[model samples]
Target: MAAPRWDLGPAREPLGLIRALQGFFSVFAFATLGGFQGSVSFHLSCAGSPNISVSAPFAYPFRLNLATFTPSLTALCNRTWARDVHLVGDFSSSAQFFVVVAVFSFLYSLGALLLYLGYLHLYRGAGGKLPLGDFLATAAFSFLWLVASSAWAKALTDVKASVAAPLPYCHPPAVICSRDTTTPMGTLNVSVVFGFLNLILWLGSSWFVFKETNFHTPPAPSTPSTM
Candidate 1:
């Protein structure tokens, strides 16, 4: 029945800071990984034709197996080239999983921050249910970040290998193919770093939120009896 009171005190506390960081880093984690667009180049040389360069472009949800690149020349050095050359690997599952977790973490952290800043009284008055829910959500996010980041890291490794490896059609004796260049994945690497950082922040904040719950209260000590 009372008017809501705004309090800035919680924003200065450790839990609030952690939530802010979780939201901040989550933006970078998903943005970098989701907005990523890069390509792998290959140089082709045949017995007598001029050297040809081709690049296969790949983007978010990185299904390399579907990426296609056409060489400049249809027929070169007495050999015909496929119009649509595809790269290898299907890493969409792991990449998407990582992005999804980052996105959700960002949304949850933002909402929690709002509640802490504008609805502190209501939160405190929730009879321990709010804190218990917060603790559980924090723990769940910590675990999710771990799984998503680890899976994405491994998938990224395979993606790099697939891009760098020579193409199957180039194995013929008449043609030779070699890697030319690979777009830098520095942003993606940073995304992984942010993911783990979020994991650490969420894991650390769990303890603080747990303390607010009744479960973390110490049992009352019984008075010692003396005769």
Candidate 2:
């Protein structure tokens, strides 16, 4: 008969804790997503041209590696960002995918923070609790992030291993191009760490919701006596 109303009930202890942690994660997510410097770098060198280097912050998804052309091979390499050092791990699609995952992670974590704050300030007085919809959304996003982060770590490791050999393109005939990447483990480690943390947070929040739902239900109204 009535549209489902927003939940407004006393907050559970665990829910409060979960919201606090969500806020913390949002801040760290911002740092790890774009603020932190990426360790991976690219170095490209061609015959007669001096070596060029491009370093990027953590490839949360992917970073474009660009090298400048020297005066010697201005005609060949050119002085633009188009010349990519083609290597196993120079600019892989998997790297870009990882960045995508990280972006979504940042957005969702930030959303969690806003939702928590909004509920606390605007809804708490009206007995508002974290709605099932919000909880479900968090659960879904967290699960996907967990999987994406795991895959990103694995993919990065594979790319690192595959790029061990030198390329023929980096020679006299074509163009001498090489890739020298910095530590790939930093991004992987951060992804895995937050991935697991988010998973646990979602699970804990779910369990708390479940407990509250079952234990604090309102009693059904009694039937009226017959005249």
Best by TM-score: 1
lDDT (C-alpha) at residue 140 in model 2: 72
In the range 89-131, model 1's lDDT, one tens digit per residue, is 8999999999999999999999998888888787777777888
Highest lDDT: give the candidate number. 1
lDDT of 2 by residue, 1-227 (tens): 32334333322356656755754664454356444344444466644567666443434343333322222233344443334333333434554444555456556555654544444444233232444445566667667656655675676566555434443334453355656765545644665576567667766766654443313554456899999
The runs of at least 3 residues in candidate 1 whose Cα sits more than 4 Å from the true structure, single-residue gaps closed, are 1-3, 72-83, 171-173, 218-227
Candidates in order, TM-scores: namely 0.89, 0.55
Residue 95 in candidate 1, Cα distance off native in Å: 0.7
Candidate 1 has which clashing residue pairs, if any? none
Error of 1 at 143 (Å): 1.2
